[model samples]
Target: MSVKSYRQALNEALHQEMARDPHVIVIGEDIAGGAGASGQQDAWGGAFGVTKGLLGAFGPARVRDTPISESAFVGAAVGAAATGLRPVAEIMFVDFLGVCFDQIFNQAAKFRYMFGGKAVTPFVLRATFGAGTRSASQHSQALYPIFTHIPGLKVVIPSSPYDAKGLLTQAIRDNDPVIFLENKLLYDTVGEVPDGPYVIPFGEANILREGSDVTIIAFGRMVHIAMDAANALAKEGIDCTVIDPRTTSPLDEDTILESAEETGRVVIVDEANPRCGMAADVSSIIAEKAFGALKAPIMKVTAPHTPVPYAPNLEAAYLPDATRVAAAARAAFTYGK
Candidate 1:
């Protein structure tokens, strides 16, 4: 195991996976940086430099650079996956998903069911999400919830470098189409990740730092925010258990329900909009299943139902910070006292 940044872990995962499987190919805009340019090739690596060294490792055939078209490239990726090629397609930004919604939701997502369990779309859609980078509303949005609503798509949001490598490895190996989301803000965050390739199965929630007072469930970059809140709460005599439900589609309902029942208070933190987001979804699950074991009302700390603001101040106010999360957890912990 070695200390690696989140970006390094993702890059390592792609490198290891492509080396392991020749059939695995990468296609996206500027993936090879300067594919046809006269200057230094593989310069950009990708929009965020996650695919930097891939062009040098694997030739141009496997590490491809597609035109500036999400609909065209994403649709092509769907077809490629259905035809036996395990393609890893990048969307650059999660906001561009609307351009190829049909290919993803209607085509790739339902291939297995549509073909009576014979089809296997072993494809992974990598996109950057979340706020706090000042990338503005257009380039910044935590849109994983939109993908999670789809039936056949598996949504993954890793909080740390360790989870990023393991979950991405698992997504590449899985037969179904996986929507692996990476928060733009987390790319620089550092954590320990295994040296070689490894896979972490889906639907398993990591109960990070257990406590008896409150249960905190978060995903993506919001997990860090929730952990900070949990740590702050601990100092004030309120212990909180932090749970990261790594994958949203194959959600570990059992672990969440168990944790909620154990603590009897849940503070779900999500960076996406409050309405119809993961926070609301988990809130519903706990309310219905673990309603009887409740000590205080479920608190959902999420962004407002508005587009991400471009201004730094507005964006900071829009995000669910540790203070807000701590306040919610404190409310739950001190209910009826």
Candidate 2:
């Protein structure tokens, strides 16, 4: 019943999870900052200061500070996870994924499948993603698609503070490896999050707003945009339903197909690029399962295929905003109606 920033929610979840389980360890580059430095050992508390107070409470043993080497530290996290530790490693930016993709996709993600369901790698890789902070091409990217493309990995994009807390907790407890994406732009964003421990089951689509005319399916921060668009559409006497499938890997196909069938109109708002991404994936799911119910072709509101631009104006235009999502939903509703 209290409001908290998205970052605080994440911090709280990590704190609570660590308190609940001794095996849950946090390893990352300067996560506790000043790791081996003389100036205040916990000075940095992470690049953006998300883990500020963690070192003081949990100490350096549980809250580790790793070298700049992503492969070594991240690979160590993966190896530790297989050996009975629930390691939550922060990759800082999703862009840095290239350095450690092999460990995730080939090792952690494939452990269970490769071993014929004998292995269980309970690990979480949290990274900041999306464009809005003018972090340029390398630091800012909506790279969920790359993770989504891989098998045995559960991908999560939490749009709000509440979802961030719940989904991250769920990811930590799950048996398989999970890639949790936090939109760098939404760190300061505030929302209500429960204080106690709770876990949101994956593969379940949350229908935030119900409507009769159109179904707007979204993920991560796009879910917030779709909700904004739904509110704007209401003024025009057009009702819209917004659905967020918290986890992309175990996608809730049943909820999506049902929503598509019920509304007979679908608009997918994804922060990722338009090509072979979440947008295309969800559109195809509805197209294949509920094609007959569609009164019009499915619509997708997504970023251009180009890499996230650095310029403020270009970045603003490149990222799909509330207006774009609303317009897309309006078009989908009108075209079908």
Candidate 3:
């Protein structure tokens, strides 16, 4: 085991996977950096430097830098996956999925089912998401829920460096199209990770904290917020259970339902908009499956249905925080009393 940043863990996962299988290739803009520049090559290593050092190890063939067109490269990745390669294509920001939605949702996601289960699209579409960096509405939307809505696509949102490494390795190895959403705010966050590759199976909800009072379900960066809230609530004698549903699509409904039944109260924290987001989806699930276990109403703490503001203060307020989560949990605790 070794302490590593989320960025480093992702880089290591890609490196290990590429070394393990020659067919695993990386394609994205500025991934190798300084591609045609006069200065040093392999400079940028991606927008946040997550792909740094990969270019030097894998070379231009495996660690490829493509044009700024997301549609073209994402389509190419889908094609490559259908043939034989396991392509890990970085879509830059989750907000940029607009240009390549057809390639992802229509083609890549449907190929296996559309072709009588014969195609194995082992393609990983990686992108940075969340709203903390003040990159404004265009670049900072938490759009994992959109991808999760698709049937054939698997969506992964890793909260910690350890989870990032494990979940990414699983996504790369899985014989299906996976949308791996990384929280940009968590790039520098450090945690203990294994030195070698490991896979955190999809659809398993990780229980970060265990308590009997209430269950706090959170996703992506919101998982950290839920942890902070759980810790604060513990100080107030309001113990809480925190769950990180690592994958949103094949959501660990059993774990969530179990936790919700144990506590009889649920507070879902999601960075996406309140309408039809993961929070809403989880709430609906608990309501439909475990309605009899409820002692209080499910409280959903999420962003308003508006574009992410560019201003730092507004953006901070727009995103869900520990204080908000704690307050929601407290409300859930007191709702029926």
Q: Candidate 2's error at 54, in angstroms?
A: 1.4
lDDT of 3 by residue, 232-313 (tens): 9999999999999999988999999999999999999999998879999999999999999999999999999999999988
Residue 97 CA error for candidate 3 (Å)?
Answer: 0.7
lDDT of 1 by residue, 38-64 (tens): 467636799988888888788789888
lDDT at position 91, candidate 3: 82
The collision pairs in model 2 are none
Which ranges in model 3 have alpha carbons more than 4 Å from their true place?
A: 33-38
How high is the lDDT of residue 101 in model 2?
Answer: 77
Displacement of residue 87 (Cα, Å) in model 1 is: 0.4
Task: List, residue by residue over 164-200, the lDDT tens digit for candidate 2.
Answer: 8989999989999999999887899998888898888
* Model 2 residue 288 distance off true place after TM-score fit, in angstroms: 0.6
Candidate 3: Cα lDDT at 58: 78
User: What lDDT does each candidate get?
Assistant: 0.92, 0.88, 0.93
